[model samples]
Each structure stands twice: as structure tokens, then as C-alpha cells.
Target: MLDKTGDAEALGFDALADLLNINRVDREKARREGWRTLADLVAVHDLENSSERRGDEWGAGSPLYQACHVALIEFIRTAPAGALPDPFAPGEIFGPKLPPTLTVV
Candidate 1:
């Protein structure tokens, strides 16, 4: 099911492929390029203009292409940027560091 603007939808691999209107080959290519989720696809939008994909198709001035681009932009803009913990942050993951000395019993 799709929500308003057709942005909010649980998009698995198949659904994402459908939304992108890409075929099996392209999908596989995208997967190979580390495009696992819809957000990943949006993040890799540079490929649309870059010489990454097999064919320079996305950059073409097509209605579907424009729509897809706009949809992704809007979706990403509206969606919440999920908060992820920083691995390097002190005490969060490593916890409090104890003294460097080790006492033998």
C-alpha cells in the first residue's frame, strides 16, 4: 500500500524495482553496487548523472525519470533521518574505561 505522494510504502527489493521501473539486470547491477534499500537508491542518485550504470538512461529528460527523481527527493526530504549511534563516541559503546593497572589477587 502507498501513502500520499506514494512515498511512504514498505519497499522491498521487488517493490523498489517496480518503483524504479528497472529490469532484472539493472536491479542486479544496483544490488551489486550496494543498493539494498530505497534510501540507498536515493543516496546513489549521483549514478543517474554519472557514468556508473551500463546505460545513460536516468539522465534523459523522460517523464518517468523526472518523476522518480522528484519523488525520491521529496521522500528523502520528508522522511526522518533515523538517529544512529556514533561508534567513536566515548562511553557509549566502549563504556567507562578502567585504570590501566591490573592487581593480582
Candidate 2:
């Protein structure tokens, strides 16, 4: 739930990663342990956001945040009623992919 006040832009990638609790270690652990549902992941995100809240740290207007929110909403909306998708599964959301690299030949 990032604020729309352009605050997220002020946050560096590390800061955003910390705020989201999706750092490498944590993400790996979570993936290994498995998240039961997208809702659960959203709850964790909201919980982290709340625990880390520092009085106007961010608001609900940040386009970045909105994009994330929308992504979650879309996931939830498209998910089957009783079948939650494995976001970490092959070709699934959040699946592992190498970062784009530029080669200077």
C-alpha cells in the first residue's frame, strides 16, 4: 500500500525491498515453505506495511503501489474459486528469472 504522493520514488530498491519483506532470503524461505494463498501474501504485505509504518512513510496513491495492488487484485480475481495458483511454480507469478543483462562485446 504505497502512497501516491510520490514517496515511493524517494525509496531506493533496497528500501522498497525491506518495506515489502520480499528480500532474497525471505522470499526464498517463503517459497520453500509455501504461501497458502494470494490473500495470505497480501496479508503479510499489509502487515509489514503496518508494522513499518512511520507516520506518513507512504500513502495509497503511489502508482507503483497501485500497480502492485492491481496485480494482486487481478491474480485474485482470475484465480479459481477453490484452487489457488502457485505463484512460485514454473512459469507462474514470481517465478525465478534471470535479470536482464547487457553485454558489451
Candidate 3:
């Protein structure tokens, strides 16, 4: 998910959220307020400060950093090659736009 700020570095979480349509209303409001901007957000350097999830499964940014991370644990778990879409946030429904990062059998 990309950040909220229009900044290129922003998580664009709003965009990801938009593509998936998970937190539309809540997120849109944030976007409008500028609170979601990459600059507005403080980067977390540890899992504790980062997202609610942990591990290298996604963009394991420190607890906080200026970047996006995966929100679909199940998708990662069930994806044929970890390229599946997030169940709650649809979009890549068309399929991966890029190749899977690693090869799995």
C-alpha cells in the first residue's frame, strides 16, 4: 500500500486502498486532510513501531519507515507464487503486473 501523501515516497496506501477499496471513506478523508502524506507520517524503524504485522513477508519496513507494506496475509499464504490479490482489497484481480520476487514450488 502506498502512503497517503501525494509525495512519490508516500505509502500510496490510499492508492492500494483505492485499488482494493478497503478503507475508502476513512482513507479518503485522511487523504484530504494531508495527514496521510509521507512527510506527515513518522517512519517507524522497528516492527513495534511499524504496522500491526511482522516478518519479511511484505515490505518489512522498520516498525516505521516511509513505504508501503502488504495488508493481505492470507493472499501471501495462499498465492500460487505470492502474487495473489488481497481478499479484502481487490484489484490485481487481473493478475500480477510484475513477476513474483522469488521462485517457489
TM-score of each: 0.34, 0.26, 0.22
lDDT of 3 at 102: 100
Best by lDDT: 1
Superposed model 1: Cα runs more than 4 Å off? 1-9, 37-61, 67-105
What ranges in model 2 sit over 4 Å off?
A: 1-59, 85-105
RMSD of 3: 15.3
Consecutive 10-residue window with the lowest summed lDDT within model 1: 43-52
Q: For residues 3-103, could you state the per-residue lDDT of candidate 2 as single tens digits?
A: 45644447644455466655475545545666323233344443233333344554453334456667778888898876886777656679876567899
Residues forming the 10-long window of minimal summed lDDT in candidate 2: 45-54
Model 3 error, position 68 (Å): 14
Question: Scored by CA lDDT, what does every candidate get?
Answer: 0.54, 0.52, 0.43
Rank order (by TM-score, best first): 1, 2, 3
Pairs that collide, model 2: 3-59, 3-62, 4-61, 4-62
In candidate 3, position 45 carries an lDDT of: 25
Please tell me which predicted candidate would have the highest TM-score against the true structure: 1
Question: Tens digit of lDDT per residue, candidate 1, span 44-92?
Answer: 4432332334445654433444566787677777876564455455555
**So what's the TM-score on candidate 3?**
0.22
Candidate 2's TM-score? 0.26
Candidate 3, which ten residues in sequence have the lowest lDDT sum?
42-51
